[model samples]
Target: MALLFWAVGVLAYLVAVFHRQSLSVAGLDAAERMGVSEAGMATLAMLQLLVYALMQVPVGVLLDRFGSKRLLLTGALTMAAGQLVFALSDNLLYGIAARMLIGLGDAMTFISVVRLVNLAFPPHRNPLLLQLTGLIGQLGAIASTVPMIASLHTYGWAPTFYGAAGVGVVMAVLLIAVLRDKPSGQAAEPGLKAAWTHPGTRLGMWTHVATQCSAAAFLLLWGYPFLVEGQGLAPQTAGVLLATLTAVGMVCGPVLGYLAGRYPLRRSWLVLGVIGSTAAAWTAVLAWPGHAPLWLLVVLVVVLAANGPGSMIGFDYARTFNPAGRIGAATGIVNGGGFLASMSVIALIAIGLEVFDDYRLAFLLQYPVWLLGVVQVLRYRAKARRLLAQLDEGLGEVRGAQEPALGTKALD
Candidate 1:
């Protein structure tokens, strides 16, 4: 029964991810159809992500109040509507509005699915389940890559997006029929104040910011262009490389999940490792004298694969540190951190490209964002660890006092 519920929620999330990333394969086409410049193209993505980032806290609050079933249903319908709008749009303003609608709906998805995971699964199983959720959800991204590109070429833009929107409607029907708020006895959690106040939540948010923004920025908009135009790969080859990013992420998700489960205290180290590796990979590619060798580009894609799973570690932090009542809000804040950073990176890169006329220089902008995020992660790591130690100490004392009472009761 738990698996059934989780599967349904995951399906909804999968479609949401598909909607979120569908634009990735269509960046060039979108710009052409809308008759917009590169910066204008970036605006469509930026505005969408901006709406998603801005809505996270509110969506979290709403999830706590209304439950995952309702949120999932509504989000599915909203995304479907947004996609339909996008399919029909022929101008920049209409496209921007459509993308924003998609963003608004996309904002409501993963967090709600996450809450469903918590409600349906036991605590000990959550880390693995979370990773699995991400792993599977990325199939949507994979679909959006080579396959979506093919679809666009074969079926044309409006039909391809119309089909994408149709998937959302189907998922909505499934949610309405099969999804539930929780098992019979479970109650909803409430309150964002506690979630916001916790150091661990902040740590998680920074972890997300550090780990996720680069990959998110890459996959969502810039990567295809970088591969095709900057690296001088054929469009087909670029699509394959973009698909490789998602496939590699799928492979890494479970391994990272196992590591996270086995070494909860060391999760941040994994995040740091991903951040450092990503920086090194980008430096290698961007600093290469000319178009980087395909192997070097492949190496960069492989490293970027870790970012999505590493971002999941942030949610693990939220789940472990906060009470059930605050999980939604805490997760929201953490989730928002990545998108907000991604949005900024996208905007900066767009501006950089417009100003510099060079992908290499524009890509350099990711460094400052990384530096800022790494500092926050380190700062919050210490604070969160201290708080966790104090919490453990207090818990040990409480358990110590209760053990003897339980022992006496057992004798009685």
Candidate 2:
């Protein structure tokens, strides 16, 4: 029964991710249909991410208030409404609104799923389960790349989007039927004030920012256009490459999850390694004289894909440090890190594209952010470890006190 309910939450998360990435996979159809420029199309994506980033705290608060089941139900229904609007609208304003709705709904799903994982699973299993959530959620991204494009070509705009909306509604219904907010009785409302003060929560946030910003920015908006328009790849080929990002992510998620699980104390090292590799990969691409080789791009995407799971390290931080009641809030703060970073990078990339007229140079703008995130992750990681150590010592002292006196003589 526990497994069944948890599966529902994960499945709902998968669907939410599918909706989130839907616009990316629309091929050229989105712009052509809406008669929007690249920047205009980017507006659709940027605003969506902007909304998703902005909503984290509020959504976190709401989840704590209402519990996971209601939020899951509401999130699904909201995404359904967004997709329906997306299907029917042809103009920019409505398209923007639709994407915002999707963003709002998307924001509600992942953290809620993480919260459910905490409620339903054993403590030791969390890192693995969290990684597994990221792994499976990426399947949604893969679908958006291949099957989504297929649907767009076959059925055309309204039908494809309507089909997506239909899935959202079905997902919502499933959540309504299956989701359990707690193990037994009601859960406590988290103190937002307390959640904000925890060093672990901040560590989680910076970890997310360090690891995810680049990958999120690339996959969510810029990568497709950079391939098709900038690097001059065929859309068909670009779609395949984009799909590969998710594929690599699915592969890497388990590995990272296992590693994080095995050496929970060293989770930050895993994140830093992934982040370093990501920076190196992007550096190679940006410094290439002409268009990067296909193999090189492939390698870069693989590294970028790892960050998706790498970013999950943030939630692991939050989950480890936070009390169960505050999980939602902590998760929200951690989750927001990447998207906010992403939003900033996307804007800078847009500017670079306009001013420099080179994709490589435009992408170079991310380097400073990489530096910033790395420093902060190191700082907070140290703090989190210290705090965790202090906590363990305190608990150990209490346990020692609770132990029976050795004998009156020994006790004396």
Candidate 3:
């Protein structure tokens, strides 16, 4: 029964990913449909993420208060409605509104699913399950790469979005029929304040910010355009490359998950490695005189692929630092970090592209963010270690007091 519920929740996440990527797959067509330039088209995705980032904390709080079942169903129906509006409408305002709705639903998904896993599975299994859920969820993204692009040519726009919306509607019904929250049935405390107050939660947010946003920006909005327009790859070839990114992510997730689980205290090292290597890869590609060689581009995408899994380390921090009661809010705070970074970089890229008409220059906008985030991640890691030291010292003192004084005497 637990497995069944988790699967159902994962299935909903898969659909949510599909809906999120659907617009990106239809990039040129969507631009044509909306009659917007590149900057304008970026807004569609940008606004969705803006909404998603804004809602994370609130959604996290709601998930804790209400449980996963209601949140999941509400999310699905909301996304479906967004898709419905998107499918039938040709107007730009309607399209933006639809994407906003999709972002609302998307915000509620992964954290809820993570919370569900915490509830349904044992602590030891949570890391593996979380990694698996994320890797498998990429299958939806993988589908969007080639198949979604093909669908646009075959059936046209309206039907494609309509079908995507239909999946959400179906998932909502399934959730109603099959989903169950944790069995404890214990009432949740109002823990948002405590969750926010924890320095570790803030550390988790910086870890997320440091690791995730580069990949998010590339895969979500800019990668396709940069490949096709900047690098001179054909659309079909670029789609294949993007799909490879997802495949590589699926392969790396388990390895990262294992390392994280094995070395809980040193997980930030994994994040630093990812960020450093991603920086290295991007430097090689962006600084290349022209379009980078195929091999270097491959390396760049492969390194970038690790970020998807790398970002999950943030949630691990949240789980490790907070009580289970506050995990939802902590998860939300951590989850918001990457999107916030992505949102900032996306806007910067759009502005850079407009000003310089250069993709390389535009991508360099990420460097400052990367530098700033690394400093914060290191600072917080030290803070978390100090926190752990204080906790251990307190525990030792408690133990010493409980035991009889060594020379003084035994307790009466």
Candidate 4:
């Protein structure tokens, strides 16, 4: 059962990631065909990400209320419609709308897959499993660059999208047949209210961590390109570098997960992650333009690779606080916050650059974002430790109080 679930999750993600990278490439082709400007094309790309971020909350809710199977099917259909729209639509507006649909569908795939893996695997194995998932997803990205370019040249963007949509449908069907709502003997109909209303759930899912994480992720995705573009590198080189980042992250993810499991101290790891990420960002700044040496490129790759650890830490944080049977919502909230932040980062950077075309300035502005994330994670760690101490003391009192009740019940 675990193997079956794992396979489904991997294959589905492979298709989704491939489709995602394919769209960006296709968008360029389509944009050229339509004579859209670079800025206009950028806006279209941002729109898809923004919509994806916006849908995270609702997608998470649907996954929580209904099982992943139904939502997966719905997402797949919506995604297919979006692709069909993109492939066939004549106007930019239609393309935008199609991208929106794709975002909606694509957003559902990540959290759903995470939740499904969480359900399928044992607790200790979750991080490694997620890393493996991340690795597979990276292939989708890796394909996007040279590989996708090659595929596009041979097949054209239209056939490529059509083929992707076909794969999405097949994945949806497999999801329907293989996926389960919950493990056997677990609650068949767990109330959403009961599962989601706890203090931990409310705080972790709704506030603090989710938003910060979202912002950081968004910064990485949208901000990185702008940073490179600002440095005067060709889009192809930037894209290659971006792909390298994901590739390293994919390889490092499992290793980090393994270390995280060994340490079992989330706070220390988060501190280290913050340090590494900060260093990486600064390294990126230093390596800008002609300064980008081979050694620095390797450094960027390793630093960018730290995203794996950062993500694992985020997942660990979510799992600790998420109420049982509510992993989907928790996963959604966590990812949603990151995506929302991403939307904001992309927008804010665009605005900043308009005034002062300085990529370094934008990069400098983003350091505080990573620092903020580190601080928040640290605060969470401190508060969690305190709460656990309180709980332990409270348990002691309860046990003391319970002995008398037990004796009385025995007498009765």
Best by the lDDT measure? 1
Query: Which tens-of-lDDT digit does each residue in 1-412 have in candidate 2?
Result: 7778778888988998899989876735778888987667778888898899888878777766677788888889999999999999888999999999999999988888877777677765666677778888888888788788788878889999999999999998788777777433333344566766877678788888888888887778788888887778887788899999999989988888777655554677788898899999998887888888899989989899898889887776676556667777778878877798888888888788778888888989999888999888777756655765555422111111223312211100
Q: Where does candidate 4 stray beyond 4 Å? A: 23-39, 176-239, 266-268, 271-276, 283-291, 393-412
Order of quality (TM-score): 1, 3, 2, 4
Measured on C-alpha atoms, candidate 1 has an lDDT of 0.85
Pick out the ten consecutive residues of candidate 3 with the lowest summed lDDT.
403-412
Residue pairs of candidate 1 with colliding backbone atoms: none
> Each prediction's TM-score against the native?
0.93, 0.90, 0.92, 0.78
Model 2: pairs clashing at backbone N, Cα or C within 3 Å: none
Instruction: Give the range of the ten consecutive residues with the poorest summed lDDT in model 1.
Output: 403-412
Candidate 1, residue 178: Cα displacement in angstroms equals: 1.6
- Give one digit per residue, the lDDT tens place, for model 3 in 1-412: 9899899989888888887777766777888888887788788889999999989888876776688888888899999999999887676898899999999999988878988888887766677778889988999888878998887789999998888888899999999999988434444446677877776777788888988888888888888999988998888888988899989999999888878655554677888899999999999999899888888888888998999899888877777667777777788888887798888888888888999899999999999998998898877766656766656422111111222211201000
Q: For model 1, how does the per-residue alpha-carbon lDDT over 1-412 read when each residue is reduced to its tens digit?
A: 8899899988888898999999888999999999998899899999999999999999887777778888889999999999999999999988998899899989999998888877777665666677788899999999889989999999999999999899999999999999877423323334577788887789889999989999998999999999999999999999999899999999989888777655544677888899999999999999999899999999999999999999988887777666677778889899998899999999999999999999999999999999998898888877765765555522111111211111111100
Error of 4 at 289 (Å): 6.7
List per-prediction Cα lDDT, in the order shown: 0.85, 0.79, 0.81, 0.58
Candidate that beats the other on lDDT, 3 or 4, i.e. the better one: 3
Instruction: Give lDDT: candidate 3, residue 29.
Output: 84
**Residue-pair clashes, model 1:** 0
lDDT for model 3, please.
0.81
Better of 2 and 4 by TM-score: 2
The C-alpha stretches of model 2 lying farther than 4 A from their native spots are: 182-190, 385-412
Q: What is the Cα-based lDDT of residue 118 in candidate 3?
A: 82
